[model samples]
Target: MARGKPDLAALETRIGRDFADKALLRWALTHVSAAAQRPDSYERLEFLGDRVLGLAVAHMLFEAFPDDSEGELSRRLAALVRKETCAEVAELWGVGPYIRLGEGEAQTGGRKKRAILGDICEAIIGAAFLDGGAAAAEAIVRAAFGPKMHEAGRSLRDAKTALQEWAQARRLAPPRYRLASRSGPDHAPSFELAVEIEGFEPAVGAGSSKRAAEQAAAAAFMAREGVTE
Candidate 1:
């Protein structure tokens, strides 16, 4: 292993796969900020891993829920593949400690940031795919996300949808979302959004994208209003 690189053997043990190409594994753990000064990073791997994850999850949901409609399966898939869920999986696999972050990002708690963790999770999957093909990647996804897929299939609704339904039940106007602010670099900008429901104080949330920020704000609002599903 490289001096500062994560213990590849340990990581393999956790994810249940050994990489034939150690370089790919290292690339998977490299954050963009770290890549800014290097020749490689996890972004490309993350892109591939995103698709691999979707395919693996979709297949799992299809077999697991033979009776579910397309819409229902999509909802569960979306919930399972969201950044928060990916971050949860990364945390479960102890990926935070393995990620290679830049000095500034490391100081600012990048390891714990949902976006970085989630991206790293996907990048690892991508690396697995490249190193050992689809079987390896599928195995990792199934191990990491299988249980969550089952639970989400049983009960999973986007925060925005849940909040709208809650408001409608009470005959209140649907919640409104507004982009409050945007910052950071073009490649990795942060978004802040405010979500408001009639007769209640608006809540603000931040994320890597406008939709994610909106969802976060909606989730916060729902929590404050004691909405659960």
Candidate 2:
């Protein structure tokens, strides 16, 4: 880990929100492992922030994609609000260094863990909401996540769902995923899975988890089939 304290002021500038209650921001950044008491940790804030993120993203989608059907909007919302997306946003804002982890967690590189980063991102949103109410929280969410909505060729729907739908549209069996291989140690394992649809060539994809591997395989199939969702 880097020496000395992280500059919270700089983080505020990057996030575009200055906390009236500076302590709240600090609270949000405090990992459970680092807290004196679990109640003082980011868990509660993360829960509230999760809801706030959904609300803000849902509102943004409703306004920006007026022509999109409810299903489309819902798909977009899911893609944007997922933990991976939240972790990506936190990385964009350089939040890892600011996270307060216990020495054990820090030694294990907790700062860069996607799950921790994602939860901290939501905790920060929850902090913003409490510090400045709905308007402030909405503004922060929009600034952080809005541009992601228009990234070129971004898949709005879950790949697994889209692939299943694609197969159903053609009266084919639903996509089947089989674990082709597994490698790496127990602490950090890698998975390779193949997705197959009847009458179509199978596609292979890899990830750290089975579900992620399945999604990757489905997405590969969709790309090869020229499917858009």
Whose TM-score is greatest here? 1
What is the model-wide C-alpha lDDT for candidate 2?
A: 0.89
TM-score of 2: 0.75
| lDDT: worst 10-residue window of model 2 | 183-192
| TM-scores for every candidate against the unseen true structure | 0.84, 0.75
Off by over 4 Å in 2: 1-3, 163-229
Cα misplacement distance, residue 222 of candidate 2 (Å): 8.3
**Per-residue alpha-carbon lDDT of model 2 for 1-229, expressed as tens digits?**
2479877899999999989999999999998778888899999999999999999999999999999998889999989987778888999989988888888778777788777788889999999999999999999999999999999877677789888988899899989999999986543457999999879899998875687789889989888989876
Task: Enumerate residue pairs that collide in model 1.
Answer: none
Q: Model 1 segments beyond 4 Å from truth? A: 37-39, 151-155, 164-175, 182-190, 197-200, 208-211
lDDT of 1 by residue, 72-175 (tens): 89888988887778888889888887887777677778888888888889999999999989988999999989988756344577788788888899999989
Output the number of the lDDT-best candidate: 2
